[model samples]
Target: MSNDVKRPSGRHHGDLRRVLEEAALELVAEGGPKACTLAEVSRRAGVSVAAPYKHFADRDSLLAALVQKGYAEQRDRYVAAMKRKVEPAEQLAAFARAYVEFAAEQRPMFELTFAAGLDKTKYPELLNAGAELFEVLREPARNLRNTEAGSRDLVLAVAAAAHGLAVFVLEGVLLNVSQAKDLAASSARAIV
Candidate 1:
């Protein structure tokens, strides 16, 4: 069976780029960047194989755009998860849980965004998106720690612990559900 989902097929000429981007995202979500080809993305998007080149310079550029887009979605998820809690400490736990959930649910994107070894400096938009994503976590940490350095350290520690649990879940050493969530939350507590 094809991993390609049925995307909206009626993109106008001006929005063909969006169609291609959506198709590429589905391809990456299914099987990481290597598995996604411009030809395949065009096919899924109801465009010609040459269509992707019109929007993206090359595959790496498309992957970079995907990374940038993924960070935007990740930041939104973090904010929504953190909003449920009133306390800064609880917000930190929520961040960890949401991080783990994102990893488990979107493992391909998680790896692409973090471990793909892509040179983010070449992609300015991706770097900005990453900075914004980290700021989401740092927002809650700022309330808990007095100094800037301390807040940065606390956020890094929590994120590191959360990332470790997410890797465990992805590797199947831990379940991707509540157990992973509990571990992520508890690890954040321990870090702080």
Candidate 2:
């Protein structure tokens, strides 16, 4: 044997976990959560069968990571959308639009995040993600509370309506993103 040792061929420094995450997401998008097996993800990512275990313990953990990413993306979208509007009502409407847009853009991952079988209690990271997402709306909600007209429960009602409308849009009942965004925004404005 030569004195020099050969490094692992395909094991790059920091991208394996990301590659696995992307593979799992693609699998989920293609066939839902059941299709996102560690084995399949590793195979798709061109890594060994044991690769995903190094990043995530099992399928649920991997799925939870995806959910966390989804929430983070949602928060970012809401922040950006709301930042462009000056009035409190416009900000609320923008938040509603971003929520619907996130669902429209990442329908599969969004659905997976809200999947009933995913027992969110097992993942504290998901709780933090949810908190961060909601925190993005806090200032806007509070501002709206002091503005023209809104009930104490108006924020809660608007969130519920947005979620319901997003679900309807994903299920094809809402037909188009334009209509869904309009419905969500109008429902939120009407609530507040």
lDDT of each: 0.83, 0.80
Residues 56-102 of candidate 1: C-alpha lDDT, one tens digit per residue: 99877878877777798889999999999998888889999999999
| Candidate 1 C-alpha error for residue 43, in Å | 3.9
Model 2 residue 88 distance off true place after TM-score fit, in angstroms: 1.9
C-alpha RMSD for every candidate: 5.1, 3.9
**Residue 170 error, candidate 2, Å:** 1.2
Models 1 onward score TM values of 0.84, 0.84
> Once superposed on the true structure, which residue ranges of model 1 sit more than 4 Å away at CA?
1-15
> Candidate 1, which ten residues in sequence have the lowest lDDT sum?
3-12
Top model number, lDDT: 1
